[model samples]
Target: MSTARFLQIHTLHTYTAALLNRDDTGLAKRLTYGATSRIRISSQCLKRHWRKAEDPHALSTLAGYVDAYRSRELVTEKVIEPLRGRHPDDVVNALEPEFQKLVYGDKADKGKKSRQTLLLGESELTWLAAEADRLAAEAPDAKAAAKAAAQWVKGKNVSVLAQNTALPAGVTGALFGRMVTSDPGANIEAPVHVAHAFTVHAEEAEGDYFTAVDDLKKDEDDSGADTIQETELTCGLFYGYVVIDLPGLIKNCGGDADLAGRIVHHLLYLIAEVSPGAKRGSTAPYGRADLLLVEAGARQPRSLAGAFRRACRPDVEEALRVLDGHLAHLDATYETGEARRYLSLAQTPLSSPEGSGLERLSLKALAEWAAAQVGTGADA
Candidate 1:
């Protein structure tokens, strides 16, 4: 059977008044939701947190999935150190443009050494580094070497690497993908859709007023505070959603369903467990999801955010009723029969269609069900 077109994961989490993500002026991030104001966490913040939360074992299990390198400096560091040992000083210096242009591409500005940072997968990186070594062996002149190098990588397509169906899957590349501004052929569309998390109920941000006293100047004349500042914070339940394109995943992994399954398992855990780390020292807003909904099906994806269009209080009973209503409306409007949903929450479980046959599964059981539907989520 064909896997679902998309994997949608949603959560509702309650956090205290400590700040999570900060804005440009060092205030807590906020956005308008449900016709009211609500605290917001950007998709970038969530993705970054997920990337950092990965353990060595988790990465290793994803089939040697090295994080994509978008920095020319970092790429240079990886490419140059190895060459320094074998090549002459002049040759090493000359090879920079060859490797840079080959891996990256022609620069936008005429005189720049390397183009803008582009996403290069593990396989692409390894291949480029090997090609650099080959260029050194083939010629001695920098211009000739660069010409040959350009010819080598410029013709390669990102989709080909994306559709690679081999082992040691390029995890980050296969999912997040890479884009080269100068080369359209090297652009790989990201298969994962990330949504900015926003509060279901809108609440105005409150400022925490405080002052720090100076330790040394404790005299009666110097009785004033050394520092006085205000920091913004919000307290509310937030809703976050992420959807994965199943066919896109298969294409990205080159039809490696087993690898995709492992990645999905790890990704779900990451999304559920990781919290945005902003103002960690003073305003550490650490919270966990009170309700998690993980679903897989061939039906077109939808969000339950509409349930809070009028905004409701943080009452469990009220929230449940609203969620059920929105979901029912969605099904009625779409008549999406090929959908499967699973829910776990703190309140009384809604009967039958209230959850739309969403079986309440344990974390382990949820992963198992997803694996059974697609492929084995076995450890690499």
Candidate 2:
């Protein structure tokens, strides 16, 4: 007789649920069954199970079996239970053992059972149906309904990493850049520059770096009959992080693999804009580059805001020049109409003199005029 090998499908489900809720710290304890610890598998492995089991006629693979069990529980509890006056026996049977394993074990064993319980119930299915109905009711047409559903599934996570820094209100629009990567074998669109510029606050340590730059004095030298003057220079270096929603950017770029490359290249440009000492082709002494491109922008913005505040206008302008130069240097770069658009925006005036209500104005008017000129030059 052949021996039957049983892989713990329920245990896998419990672990997956825990992972979704970011409960990795207690995963080992949460997944224990009998005397043996359940083998740890990645969320990627679980995703493979879902893909393989998606076909209706697909054989009873481990993932498919788990998915079927989950679907039936949702239907029974959400659709059948209230109508039939009884809960599904299988739902309780499928969940109770794992509940006991999690709840009855040691202090370490008590993990995210409450979260797992919600997954096992009809709530998700109910919510999905309700959402679909709400969309249908609210949307003007069927196309709008479909669009809403598409956006809901492709929802993004946007974060602003502005910690203890006081940024000019206009900085918000300049910092809004996307990050994305190309799909395998996809042709990359030509890269474009995306500038991220800011100034540092006075209180922060990183802010001190820029203030030192501003305080540099001019040097002068005279020889024979001529006089010469030179301005002192300061090297500004600060640390900061840019938060991005990679998946969202990919969607926004219309799911084009080529466009995704451009988006990612643009993000790299933004990072380089803020970190002058960090170059793409350059290696640091520690074998690590000065700039760190963090995925999901996980680091807290508060931790980085101080460093960002140290970035003065000159530093930002220099960074933008570097970014533009890098894009022009790319051998395979393609013209994606971004450069022309940027140039047009940079040249366009914000408001006319009449709009400013200053036909014959004072020094404040002249100051505003000078500031506008500076702003246009900085953007250029």
Candidate 3:
């Protein structure tokens, strides 16, 4: 209902971490943001950490974070194997026509496995198997079932039909999205865009030499460092930004507007609380964003990360002052009247705009407010 296609989200965090995310060589990832050098973490690394995390607040099968696993074995492992002996004839035959087109599109191959396996979630897989089961039970024979499946595949947009019918197992598809490389038609674009996290100030990467002894060599007479390696590290306040496109999310999910909103709610909490697992054993760089700000509106989304281009002194008062000035400048230049809400959580002091209509909120309250933003837009 928001009429707008996107809900941009951005954050500024200061961390006291030591080598939070590192490269293959064990050096911290680095980037030049706005102009100055800064510690950095790749978007891919951040996403992998989120998907693999098991925290109560993070997405987990036990916690009911709706998701699917993409694999060729979905036809066998998820469906056929689970219902083996229960169905006569090859079970894969019963589902190929129905699932292949939806997942593979023009590159669909009935007898062969997908060139690139789709990471289909359990929810979608289960739904597909259930539909196949119904057909297997209804059809007089395997040949008949395959025939019926072919007819089922002839619907308008089989990809949309298969997914739209089943509420996605979780929010993964809606938030992170998917792309079927072999079949562009099966691609589901991700609504959220995360920028590489960078330090707020200019800093040079430092190398630390360290030694690791193998437990097996611990009692050996010649025992020395089994492995000697140098690792790089950097510590400082960092700025990270994420933009969520609301309407684009709905489109990817086949018009499930409510689901798009729910995914945002979960992501709001997940992004702030989660840390990338770059080098936990050697450098457990762990810290949460001390300052978080959420701004919602119909205005064109923009990142204020450039605010750190010059590298300001590390002080809470000064940081907030700079942010306030940037916000003022953006407001004056852009017809930002499209902005409807501002929710902020700050550990340090922040001077409020005299009458700018900004709401300072706790993190939980902010997430709740953001969760409810779906249906309400400029018209609502």
**Ranking under TM-score, best-scoring first?**
1, 3, 2
- lDDT of every predicted structure (CA atoms): 0.67, 0.26, 0.64
Off by over 4 Å in 1: 1-3, 55-64, 72-74, 108-114, 137-169, 211-224, 338-343, 354-356, 376-380
Error of 3 at 374 (Å): 2.6
- Candidate 3: stretches off by over 4 Å: 1-6, 16-19, 22-26, 59-65, 70-76, 80-114, 130-170, 214-223, 248-262, 314-317, 338-355, 378-380
Once fitted onto the true fold, the runs of candidate 2 whose alpha carbons sit more than 4 angstroms away are 1-227, 269-293, 297-303, 306-380
Candidate 3 worst ten-residue window by lDDT: 161-170
Cα deviation of 96, candidate 1, in Å: 1.7
What TM-score goes with each of the models?
A: 0.83, 0.20, 0.75
lDDT of 1 by residue, 1-380 (tens): 33466677878877787788888898878888656887888887887677666553254456645556556564476665677777665566666764555545555223345457656666666655665677777867666665665576565644444343342225665777666675676666677888898888877578899999988885887788999998887777888888887767766766677767777777766766667866677767676666667766677788878888788887656776777678777777877653454555666664455334568776666666655554521111
Mind giving the per-residue lDDT tens digits that candidate 3 earns over 45-117? Answer: 7777777667765655323345667565556566556556777766446656566665555555545554456
Candidate 2 displacement at residue 29 in angstroms: 54
- Give each prediction's root-mean-square deviation over alpha carbons: 4.1, 26.7, 4.7
Error of 3 at 354 (Å): 6.1
